[model samples]
Each structure stands twice: as structure tokens, then as C-alpha cells.
Target: MIQQTLTQLRELRLSGMANSLLSQIEQPATYEGLSFEERLQLLTDSEANDRENRKQQRLLKAAKLKLSAHARDIDYQHPRGLKQSVMASLLQCHWINKAQNLLITGPCGSGKTYLACALGETACLQGYSVKYYRISRLMLALTQAKADGSYSKALQNLAKIDCLIIDDWGLEPLTAAQRNDLMEIMDDRHEETSTIIMSQLPTDQWYQSIGDNTLADAILDRLMHNAHRIKLKGESMRKIQSNLTDGEHLE
Candidate 1:
């Protein structure tokens, strides 16, 4: 009867319950102690938890973030313009719910990617889908997609992501074609989905980086006006890490 029940549970896709049932039957002494309601509760909770865990794993795999960082691991001690209070508010994820964009600006090695990844991970945990891309790489892929007749499909895919993290936003120069492509992407995501852009350049220089004055104006109007900004300051973290090899802490 137990073997038949385990097979039935597996057939019904109740993997969590099947495993729990096997464990319970293996230890009849313990199972005899729990009330019927407690046993049922355990099986139900196990199934629900397993399902949630699988969903989260799927989300994290799809995210493909540059850094494997979590919000709780954020370094507040580094005086790099990060504010724990602000981060705490952001962690509540209210801005994402409202479809607000985040702009993280800083010098090289200021941990922009780390912070962005942390937030992206948070979004994934909250059941929001996320995608990450470097602007240069994303643009190249877009150009390829256009040649293969999947340009529109690519944009549609980008539009569907709940959160898009564009790392190294201003690293590459934008051509006329790339500029238009960017406009389409931003236009689709505007006021509907959240985007986190990490750039080493100051926000003011972004206009110059993304040349074509008219296109720049339109793109910035969409991405900047309603965005929350974080400007990270301080020396390169790389420098600090390099000094740690001598076994002395950075002062």
C-alpha cells in the first residue's frame, strides 16, 4: 500500500509530499506521534515550499546577473556614497512596484555592478523577472537580431522583463542605428517597467556619450526624468583590495 501510494503521489507531481511521505513511513515511531492534522500540514507545507523554491531558482537562472550579490551583503562601511537608509527603502521594493527607474553613477571600481546585482537579485526573489546586459553587448546582439529578422522579437522580449539591468551604460559610443534601437527599448519600458542603469560617467555627460542631440534629448527625457539616482564616490575598491595582499587593512 505504501509503495502504491508513493507511486501515485509521484504520478500526481507531488514530489515534495512523496518524499515527505517516504520519510515519515521510514520512521513510524515519529509519525505515530504527530496528529493527523500536523502530518497533513507538513506535507502541504513541503509541497508549497518546494514549488516556491523551484520558481525562485528559475528566476535567478534567467537573471544571469554580472555579480552574485545580495542586498543584505551590501557594504555600508565603504563610504562610497551608499546610504543604508536609502538602500533600506529601496529594499522594500516599492519603487519597482511603481515602475520607477534607478540610475547608479560612479567612478571606476565604486561597486556599481555589485549594488545593481544585489537589487536585481532582490527583484528576482520578490517574484519579478529580471535580465541583465552590458550596453555594448546588448547593442551588438540587437544589430545581429535585426539582420536575422528578429529585431522586433528582441524588443518585445526586453519589454516583457520586469526589471532590466543595463550595466556599463555609457561605455560604448552610440551610432544612429543604435540610438534608434535604444529609443525603441526605452519607449517600450517607459512608465511601465523598471530599469537599473550603471554608468561610470556623470549623468550630465550621458548626453554627450549618447550623441545625436535630438535622440539624446528624447532618450534622456524618458530614462532620466523619472529615475532615482545614486552617485557613488571614493577611491577604487580594486586599489583597496590590492593592498589587502600585504595583510594590512585599508585605512
Candidate 2:
């Protein structure tokens, strides 16, 4: 009878439940205290939880976040800029649900990318699809996709994601083609999907970095409005870590 039940569970693709049942059979004492209905309920809950865990794993794998960052790991102890209240609000993910943008600007190693990845991880944990890309690499990939005649398809895929994290925005001057490509991406995602941009340049200098006046305005119009801004103000986090390491070594 138990073998038949295991076969039925395997056929139904309830592997989690099947495994739980097998464990119970292997060590009957483990579940001897539970009633029949309680045992069934426990197995059912295990199956549901297994499915959720697998789904979350797939989403996190696809997110491609640079750091293994989480909302809780955010360093509020060493003041970067914004208050804990601001981070708490953002962590709630209301902005992502509302299809807004988030801009994180600061000098190199100022923890901008880390914070962005942390938010991206949060989005993933919330069951939102996410993709991470450095601006230069992303443009290159787009250019190659265009060469392969998959540019339209690429944009469509990006448009469907719940959150898009673009690191190193405005790192270099943009060509006309790059400007147009960026405009298309911003236009497609605007008011539809959320975006997180990490940049070293201040917001005011973005227009100059974008190069083409008209296209620059169009891109910024889509990104800047209806977006939250976070400017990290402090020395490079790397330098701080290095100093801490030196102190530890001396001790």
C-alpha cells in the first residue's frame, strides 16, 4: 500500500511529499504521534514549500546580482548618506510595484553598486524577475544582438522583467547609436517596469555624458521623473575596509 502511494505521488510530481513519506516510512517513530490527517497536511505543506523554494532559486539565479547582498545586510552603521527610514521605505518595494526608477550616484567604491545589488536581491526574494548589467557591457551585448538580428527580441525580454539593474551608468561618453539604444530601453521600460541605475556621475552631469542633446533629454525624461534618488556621501568603502584590516593586523 505504501509503495503504491509513493508511485502515485511520483506520478503526480509531488516529489517533496513523496520524500517526506519515504522518510516517515524509513523511521516510523518520527511521525508516530501525528494523526492521519495531520500527517497528510504536513506532507502537503512540504510540497508547497518546496515549490516556492525552487521558484525563488530560479529567480535568484537569473537576477545575476554582483554581490550576494540582502536587505538585512545593508550597512546603516557606517553612514553612507540616507537615513534608515529611507532604506526601510525602499526595502518595502513599493517603488518597484509602482513602476518607478531608482538612481544611486556616488564616487567609485562608495557602495553604490552594493546597495543596488541588495535592492535587486530584495526584488528577487519578493518573487519579482530581475536582471543585472553593467552599462558598457549591456550596450555591447545589445550591439551584438543587433548584429545577430535579435535586438528587438532583446528589448522585449528586458521589458518583461520586474526589475532591471544597470550598473556604471554615465561612465563614459555615448555615441549616437548608443544614445538611441538607451533611449529605446528607457522608453520601453518607463512606467512599465522598474529600473535601478548606479552611477558615479551626478545627476546634473548625466546630460553631458549622454552627448546628444535631444536624445539625452528624452532618456532623462523617462528616467529622472518619477524616480527616487540616493546619493551616497562618504569616503570609499574599500578604503575604509582596508584601514580596518590594517588596524586588525597591527593588533
Candidate 3:
């Protein structure tokens, strides 16, 4: 009986050690020697870290669905850096009560899309919902929804997100019907939620691209009213990175 009791105690101690080792492997900063309070802190930290990583992964997946094709790897320290006002405005998005809009305009490869995605991800991280979609895909989706008699449901879903990013505006001229659908969305979201628009074309040319004088005026009025507008000016990061890689290979 004495031997059996000793064996049972030994098994229990070994099991405890195994569990501690598993915990350490899963969370490198935690260990068996920690005090009770320290252990609680470590657990909290582990959970928070897991949550943040998961959030970033989900946001990246949603951005991919919109064909963003880039990470929110914004370099705030560039020579021709983002304007201070723009950065401050983006950080203050949580305080915006009226569904204000943000517009980013630049030539090709000027980081317009990247900045917009980064801002949208910021809104997501701050506990607000976000949806990112390309302008072309948005129009096509509306067309299909109209055909299938699901247009109202689709619009409802779009309106629910806290922040919506419409990318690649002015890539192609919109038809009259397409313009009307876009106006409906903008009007619905104008006072209730925020929006981000990334376009390569200047604001003055939007009337020509959207194909409706009234919509062009109304949409621009809502979007520009107390809106934050940023203009990006820089060469294409892709081309620069490619050239750097080629130079390193030659060396």
C-alpha cells in the first residue's frame, strides 16, 4: 500500500510538470515559477495578444477580398510623408459622430490604396465594423443583386458596416443606372456611417467619370462636407522595391 501511494504521488507530480511545459511552449513568457498574480497577468497578456493577431488576420482577409493586394505597412517617416492633419484625422475617426467621409487622391503607385486600407483597418481594430470593396466590384454586385431581386438586402448589408472603403474610383466610366445605385448607397450612408474613397483621378473630373451632373454634385457635396482629404505624391513603391532587389542581385 505504501509503494502504491508513492507511485500515485509521483504520477501526479509528473502530470503537473507536463502541463507546465505545455503552457510554456504555447506562451513563451509564462512559466511554472510565477506567483498567482503574475500568472493571471501572463494569461491576460496571452489572450490579448491572440485577439490582436486574430483581428489583424481577419482584416487582412477582408482586404484581400477587395483586391487591396498590400498590407497596412504604412511608413509614417517617409521624406514626403503623409500630412500631419491627415494622420491626426485618421486617428480621431472614433470620435466622428456624423458619418464623415475620407478621400485619398493620387497618381498611380502613390500609396493611395495602401493608406486607405490602413485607415480602414484602424477602424476595425478600434472595435468598429469595416467593409472594403473595389468600386468596379461594387457596381457589378449591385447589378447582380438587382437582377436577382436581392438589391434591398444587399444595400442593407452594405449600410450596416461602420466604415466602408470604395477603392479604385474612376477606373472606368459608370453607366446611368450604376451611378444611381451608387448615389443611393452614398445617400444612405452619408449621415449614419463613415466612408473612405481612394481614386487616381482628381475630384474635379468626377462629374465626367460618373456620367451624371446631379449625382456628381450631390455625392461630392456629401463627401466633401467636413471630410478629410489627402493627396499622395510619390513614385511607385513596387517599382522602387523591384529596382532595389535587382541591384542587390547584381552585387
Candidate 4:
């Protein structure tokens, strides 16, 4: 029995142990005392803990990025076949410090959202804390918070993130209160943290969309002053793909 245990331990790569009864082994080596089933359970528990540790490390790595995509993958040379210098310049990630915002304006079907999401994804990967919220969803969340008397906490939470990416900024009309809320959030983040505002409307029209001149001024002032504006060009990637594939592939 001792010889058999020693051989098994050797084969298992458990060093410094020979075949010893389960009762005689000390801790750890005692772990070797248990039956194969018990050992398997311990191994399984250890694997699970290792997996969780890896997952947590990945999450931590994603949160530290300030500018999500590094410059090379941005396709600056091609510009997706458009000749826009500004788009390339924005990829440098320098504007983040100027309390500058990113304003992405382009017609629907263009790569506006893709570009914005890519940038946000890059930021996450680079270890900068980022918060991604769709315009409609954010408004709904704020509305819910107001109803629940947690609006202050919600706004404070928004303020804490290092970078906030608001996708689809003008998909719906904003109420007076929502406008104020947005302005306040932007105001707090202005010149302090970085922001990415993705909108289909042109910069000139943002004022009309928001419906309050004072709030609009406050919002745009901070956004444009330090912002690295990128105006994407070309037909919507969606339409182009649909045309190529005859709409057979549904996204």
C-alpha cells in the first residue's frame, strides 16, 4: 500500500510524499490521504478560484484605460476611405487632458456609433474607468432615480467615472428637467474628466435639440472648448453591408 501510494503521488506530481495512510499525512499532504473523489473536489475548487481571479484581473485591466484604442488600429491612413484630418488627429488621445470632449457627428448608417464604441472599448482596455450609457437609457435611469429619490447619488456616481461615453445623444426629445440634469452632469465633468458625446445632429443644431439656451451654452461650451471633434463620413456601414449582402444577414 505504501509503495502504491508513493507511485501515485509521484505520478500526480505531489512532491515529498510517499505512500502514507490518510491518517498519518499532515495538512496538504493529508489532502493526499483523502480518496480520489475528495482530491478531485479540492482540485475543482482550486480551479474555480483561479478562474475567478483571472476574471477579476481582466476587469481591472479594462478599467484603467484612458483612451481605449491605441493609435495604430484606428486606420488613420484610410479613414475608411474618407479624407478627414480631424478624425485622425482625434485618435492621438491628447485631447483627454484639455477637459476636451469627443463630439462624433455623422448621418445615420455611417460609422459614428461604431467609432464611438470602439473608442470607448479602447478606453476600457487601456485601464481608464469608463461609463457607457445610451441617451435614452440614461434619461430613463435619471427619471427612475428621481422617482426613487436617488437622483443625487446617481449623478454623483456618474461624476466619479474617469470617462463617460454617452451614446445616441439626441435620439429623443429632452424634457426641461432632463436638459438641466444633463447640463449639470456635463458641467461637473467639464474641464475635470473626459467625455464622449455621440450625436447624429450637427453641432449647430445641438442647441435646438436641447431646448434651453443657457443649458445648451453650458453644455456646448465645455464640450467644444477642449473637445476633439471627429466628423465621420461615408454611407452608413449598415446600408453598405445590406447592399452588399442583399439584407440577408440581420444584425
What is the descending lDDT order? 1, 2, 3, 4
Q: TM-scores, in order shown?
A: 0.92, 0.91, 0.72, 0.66
Per-residue lDDT tens digits for candidate 4, residues 1-251, read: 76677578658754323322333444565575678877766655554565555554574454433234443455444344434466555555556545568888887866665666566555554445666778888888999999999999998988877678787777788999899889879877877889888888888899888888888888878778877676766666666556556466667
- Model 4, residue 102: distance off in Å is 0.6
For candidate 3, write residues 1-251 as lDDT tens digits: 63464456347544333433347657766465677787656545655666676776775565443434323456655544477566766766653455778888888877777777667666656656778889998999999999999999999988877788899999999888888888889888877888888898888888788888888888777777867788776776656656556457764
Task: Please give the TM-score that candidate 1 achieves against the real structure.
Answer: 0.92
Ranking by TM-score: 1, 2, 3, 4
Question: Looking at candidate 1, what is the lDDT of residue 85?
Answer: 92
| C-alpha lDDT (0 to 100) for residue 181 of candidate 1 | 95
Report the Cα lDDT for residue 231, model 3: 76
Residues 44-129, model 2: lDDT tens digits: 98898888888888999999998998788788877778678988999889999999999999888888988888888888878899
Model 1 / residue 213 / CA error / Å: 1.7
Lowest lDDT block of 10, candidate 1: 242-251
Clashing pairs in 3: none
Top candidate, metric TM-score: 1
What TM-score quantifies how close candidate 4 is to the native fold? 0.66
Which 10 consecutive positions of candidate 2 have the poorest summed lDDT? 242-251
lDDT (0-100) at residue 209 of candidate 3?
85
Runs in model 4 lying further than 4 Å from the true structure: 1-92, 243-251
Residue 97, candidate 3: Cα error in Å is: 4.9
lDDT of 4: 0.68
